[model samples]
Target: MNGPGGYFGGCLTALDDCLRGTFGYTAPATLLWRDASTAREHLSRALTAEGRPYDLFAGTLQVLAEGGMHVTLA
Candidate 1:
């Protein structure tokens, strides 16, 4: 992933930078560049067991808001 419109996935460095500028959480505790199988497992963990999306979305919104970032949802 690169910056605004990366093809594979969102650039986590960009996300971390966004969070740093906003809520003071930076650099990341973990960054996983997964192969396809591991990536599926990761998604499963987030969507079900950890429920990461529900927890993360609002905080992400806040970070983006604080950073004055506006994205068009298309």
Candidate 2:
């Protein structure tokens, strides 16, 4: 989606904005995510500000789905 060395921020909000065409790509797109299992495993252990367990992988998928992106986990 982005050019080489292009950055669109690291937070979910930024990801949502990028999916909305804020950076360039349009919504309702398709994404082939390779090695998603590893990402999921790591993100699943993430924590929130209040030290609560946060499923970042699920949250990220939610954001992507909300942005109209169909993700295929490989």
Cα-based lDDT for every prediction? 0.43, 0.82
Clashes of each: 0, 0
What is the TM-score (0 to 1) of candidate 2? 0.83
* Candidate 2, pairs of clashing residues: none
What are the per-residue Cα lDDT tens digits for candidate 1 across 1-74? Answer: 34333332264346646455544433333333236454444443344245544333444444555545553322
Each prediction's TM-score versus the true structure: 0.31, 0.83
Q: Where does candidate 1 have its weakest 10-residue lDDT segment?
A: 25-34
Error of 2 at 62 (Å): 0.4
* CA lDDT for candidate 1: 0.43
Minimum summed lDDT over a 10-residue window in model 2 is located at 1-10
Q: Candidate 2, residue 66: CA error in Å? A: 0.6
lDDT of 2 at 36: 98
Off by over 4 Å in 1: 1-54, 71-74
lDDT of 2: 0.82
